[model samples]
Target: MRKIIENYGSILLLLLGIALGSVIGLLTPHAVEYIKPLGDIFLNLLFVSIIPLLFFAISSSVANIQGENKLGKIIGLMSIVFLVTIVLASIATIAVLYFFPVSSGMASAGVMESPTADNSSWGDRIVKFLTVDEFNNLLSRQSMLAFVIFSFLIGIAARRAGAAATAFTSFLNAGNEVMKQLLLLLMKAAPIGLGAYFAYQVKTIGPQLFGFYAKPMALYYGFGIVFFFVFFTLYAFLAYGRKGPATFWKNNIVPSLTALSTCSSLATMPANLDAGKKIGIPPAIANVVIPLGNTLYKNGSAISSILKIYVAFSMLGWNFFDWNTIITAIGITVLVTIVAGGIPNGGYMGEMLMISVYGLPNEAVPAVMIIGTLVDPLATILNATGDTVAAMLVTRLSNEKFAPSST
Candidate 1:
């Protein structure tokens, strides 16, 4: 009973929150509005924690890479694989949207004010991304992409610092662990916080929020399921042919289910590691690649990001076929998705980047958040399962012999 609750508790709580929130919204709209602050406070807490979480988690992971001789090769190969998969996923998203376009009726939804001014040139935006005032950017929620870049450089420098880096790396790792504990504590209160927020959302938008976004949601889930089976199978074949494909499915079942239930790839890491061992991946490779991949390889989020951009463009009546728009959409999707971690609503930062980079209406942020929240389980399953697949590829490419091993 304890084990079952431990596995399913969070998902059950989330569903309960949604159901109760909807009822309150319908029966007591005014009261729901009053409860909105609880939700706002919860969201603000999450936002405040995410910057430091990304910084320490990513930098520490990078700083801990053990094989100095093989580090460059391993990281390069893993990155190539990650980039290729994300690009393919993005293309799949574009193709899916092309076939089943989002409804223009989304324009009728209430538009929030666009947050940033739209006068910045592409060159100016690029410059700002690379050279923001570090102290100021650290405080602003909008600077996550820059923050990730800065943290990554710091991590690499720490890796090169030899024995002197151990203390700093230990500190970052400890900080990351503390943040995870904080997240768990927050999650325990999520039912109340999310319930209040959802109630307010239903009150403001009416229950029609679901119907308003139905078509795009359908597209997202439909394509997501298709991609998971097809893409993972292809990856299995590339890693080791027929035998590998069979092992992939057999090993991934538990991790896939955990990811789906938790809606969190990071939360699924233990299961992924177990699956990696079952499938004969070397522990050395699995340990390094799985953690690193959790931070960097986000094919699932890349697909979701593409869909968000399409939905935003559909709502705004932008020309999707424009070359400049297409390039920007794909580029930012890849960039933001890389940093999209496994927390619920973790993709919010990525959505903000999309809005800023594409000059999207700030109102689109909430819509994207709604979409991400609804489809998080599916996205997470793909993200978590894909990490194991990446580990397999990395192991095979590195010429690491697959001997069946368990912790």
Candidate 2:
């Protein structure tokens, strides 16, 4: 019991907070006016942190990409594999959500603030979504897409400048650490913040708030299991035909367990590297891929991002079937899952992206942040373990026998 708490104490505390708040809200609906502010304050603290966090983390990760010393076939192959896998993962999520749709109806739908419809042309919307008119505008949450684009450019510029940008790179690295620490400090209040937030939601929206999650939560976990066994097997087979699936599965036990137990992709690296070597991924490939994968590859987050977007859309009373929305959701999934997955509390950053991109009200984030949290354990398994399989796929395509320094 003590061991279980140590591993999962935070999640348990969050759930307990939610339970207590739910009881308060349901028993005394009038308490919302008093408790809602706590949730709002917490959410604001998170929102305030995202811009600087993304600016530092994304730029630093891109600037410090390990493959710069030797980037040719292997790096190219890794990029293809990462893009293909994340796209496939998002498509798989879209298909599942299409069939077993998440519940959307809240008894008090008015509790959610809806964005006013923008009847702009697709071209205009695209430009608006991806760029800000003024530099100052980029700092606001509404310009998250623009800010992300800017960060990537900054990182690329720094990388290209090499020795000239050493000081800038150091600053980015330091800033990333500072932002991570700040977020960690802030999250010490999650149990209270999320609990109060949920309480306000339950009181305003009624207890059906829990029911709204029942199907989607169950479906996410259920699909994660199926995706792990089924799609991962398919990826493995593609990597090393016939015996590949067995080999991949047999070797991944430690990495998978490490991912679950430690909940950190960086923590699972040694085991993942060992698993890749056992599966015959060349050192050149495994060395670059596993470390880079922690920062840029995330099959698990792809699915989770898509689900969070869909749930936010559903709650906002938007049409999920709209072609524009579907395309945009997939695009957002690839960006957030890969780019944002490296940082601490990145899920919340990703949620902020969704809310900003869709013009959804602030309430949408709290609604989806819980889903991100609950799904994280399973998500981390796919993410950490998938790197080895990805390395195999790269190996299969790049030829089986290669020098260790071929990368």
Top-scoring candidate (TM-score): 1
Q: Count the backbone clashes (under 3 Å) in each candidate.
A: 0, 0
Compute each candidate's TM-score over C-alphas: 0.65, 0.59
Backbone clashes, candidate 1: 0
lDDT digits (tens) for residues 308-403 of candidate 2:
888877877778878899999989887776555433235665666676688777667566776666666678888878888888888887775522
Point to the candidate with the largest lDDT.
Answer: 1
Which run of 10 residues does model 2 get worst, by summed lDDT? 106-115
